[model samples]
Target: MTDLLDPVSPDRAESFLTDHFQGVLVRPGDRSYDEVRAVWNGMHDRKPELIARCTGAADVSVALRYAVAAGRAVTVRGGGHNVAGTAVSDGSVMIDLSLMNRVDVDAGALTARAQGGCLLRDVDSATLAHGLACPAGVVSHTGLGGLALGGGYGWLARKWGLTCDHIVAAEVVLADGSIVEATEDDHAELLWGLRGSGGNLGVVTRFTLRLRPVGPVHHRTGVFPLADAAAALALYREFAERQGPDLHAVATLKIAGQQDWIPERLRGTPALFLTATWFGESAEGPEHTAPLFATAAPDAVLTRLLSFAELQALGDHGEPHGNRYYTKSCYLTDLTEGPVGQLLDATREIASPLSAIDFEYLRGAIGDVPDEDSAFPRRDAPYICTVSAQWTDPAEDAGHRAWSRRGVERLAEWHFGGAYVNYLQDEQPGKVAEVYGSARYARLAALKRRYDPENVLSGNQNISPAAP
Candidate 1:
């Protein structure tokens, strides 16, 4: 065994790793090392000592065992889309699962099994081909593993619940280099913890998710001038509270850019945008979305029936890879005037044109799930507020981050003090407890102790092992 923290002879390490590993191995000076290390967020620029491009569960187990024997820190990468960039670390053993992307859809069973590296698009393309869909994140390029583990929500959440809610089973690689299948009947507690506690207990090699029959959906997008944003938000709040499970909506405050949806006059101006989707009849969508148009009298309105995959793809353009991204978010108990005003004030001083304040309406099926069903605890939150700062210039990082922090602080009074763990960045400390309350966190820690006693998997939103 070698000390992973201390410097070891490269020739010896490379030879040893090559003798034991079957997948592709890249050392520090390898030609593709830089490309392998680049994740979705440009904020993290780390150089791992070794990169193991695992092909399957066997490869993952081999890598983990080797890392444990060598006493090296390990990080896992699946689609490499984490905003916090926990997938890569300096001088660590990076288990790159990007090559393991394989999706198998069983229409007969109404379920889909995806490898750990499969992105949302990979699963969507396969399942949608069969006219079936799974609840997943909005961004098509995001890794399904991280999103599902952190409680996935998107256009279909109101109708079918979160991505984690639909997960029937998962194949996980435990810390002790053993593989196990977690389902309702076997290793059930571990399965419950995996629903929302993030990549804390172990590395999931594959996920088996329940699928639902989904067809074309009615989509409505409205853009209103900044002057009428407050009134529009109030109307939206009222409508969202009373809306049915088949309808899902989002309110966004952003500097209108050159998007095709935005009218020419609204471009480059501060504006409020409302987007609503109806999973049922197309005719009913306009009825549910009429209140937004009546309130804001938007400059432009685009409503049409679109395929489910197309609706999911819409989020891809706004959030592209290689851009510096920072986010501050909280789950709001309600959307009252005070918090709305604070959000507006925060948006008034936007650091970058790409920056925006977003609100996602939550309830219906999301809240129907009991609090103790999974590690995710904030089921009663009616909405979630996020201040997303995106910029291309590295020099402007400080201003943008500070702006987001201040925005979250101003709206703290209206929030439940809990945040979506998936959206959390590296800078937010002590957030694990907030995301999962004390009782739930304690339960997760106990599970962590049983599955990973030494805390070998501490690269993610970690839950420390409970004391004996």
Candidate 2:
């Protein structure tokens, strides 16, 4: 193995990756630099020293070697959808994986191998063609690399579990430029770390995810006036407890938007939205969704039956690229009166109409995996509260970021578990350890020491190799 921290001259960094790399190299002044470096969150405007658009795992290994030898901060870019904008660091060598997007599904085995650069839409479209699906994040455009490596939640989460759970195997490039295929029989611990610990351990080049049969599903949305939210919540609590494994439900509070169902006068008003999906059979969907439409005195209501792939794309409209985004989230032991009320109240002070707060009920298949089964923690947490800030003006950046933080801070009393890594934007010192607790963080830290001892992959939701 080569030394991970050997310092080569800065002048040779571009040449190093190009010498043996089978990918295109993008420079700062290159015509495509601006476009290639752009991430989903408009908040990040980083200019990397070099961009290696890797075509395969071989290119990933070489990119890491160049970053290591050149002593540059190395960041990896998949779909570039992370809210934290960790993909492009200042003066770093970006291992760009956007060109490696290719999904190969084995119809016989019911498994799909997606490259690091694949977005959720890439995998969803591919698997659905074979009449199979992989449970993943709600946004179809979300990067498979980040979502699978962190923890994925979606309409299918209730029946199939998180996207990370389906990742049976992966090709990872270590800090020292060594490639390893991680599966049950080889580097099993590394695979565990990849399951939920973020990409802190290594650069995952490809993921083999197990697939299940999925098809057209049911979806319903009931919008209630903010004043009547308390009553809606009470009904939702009862309705949620009665849900089966095929039912996935979520409650969102946001400013009402212009839609046919929503009266023009109520368009700008704050309202509570109840949405549900039944992933079983299209014929069986309405029965599961009836209660969602039963809420008394809803301001507006709409229901639809669409394919699982289509419902996944539904959220894409609300979360478009080029919006400045920041998020703060925490896992709740349960969604009780206190936390729910507080979370709802926090939304009233939104800095942007695009901002929204979501309360997701966790049930069913997610708990099927033991806490020790993978690096993902808080499997027992019953709810996750996400306060997201989305706006365009950079002048109000501090205020928006602070609002998101304060929203989560107010729930500190009810935040019984560490946050969901996928929804996190920032955490104070010692918080990363809190994400896994002492035992699991220690295990992950030890593994980090073995694979990325120099902490070359540090930043964002960082896991220090040093003993926790």
Query: Please, what are the lDDT tens digits per residue for candidate 2 over residues 1-468?
Result: 324335546687666655678889999889999999999999999999999999998888888888877888889998899899988888988889999889999989999999999999999889999999888888888999998899888778879899999999999999888899999999999998999998889998999999999878888888888888888887787788678898888999899998888878778988899988888778888888888668565777788989777888999999999999999888876667888788778978886899999987896899899887799998888888888899999999999999999998899888877888877765678887888899999999999999999999985588999875
Error of 1 at 122 (Å): 0.3
**Pairs with backbone N, CA or C atoms under 3 Å apart (clashes), candidate 1:** none
Cα-based lDDT for every prediction: 0.85, 0.87
lDDT, candidate 1, 220-314, per-residue tens: 88888888888888888888887888888899998998979788888988888888888877767778767756756778888888988898898
Query: How many clashes in candidate 2?
Result: 0
Every model's TM-score: 0.95, 0.96
84 Cα displacement, candidate 1 (Å): 0.8
Instruction: Count residue pairs with overlapping backbones in model 1.
Output: 0
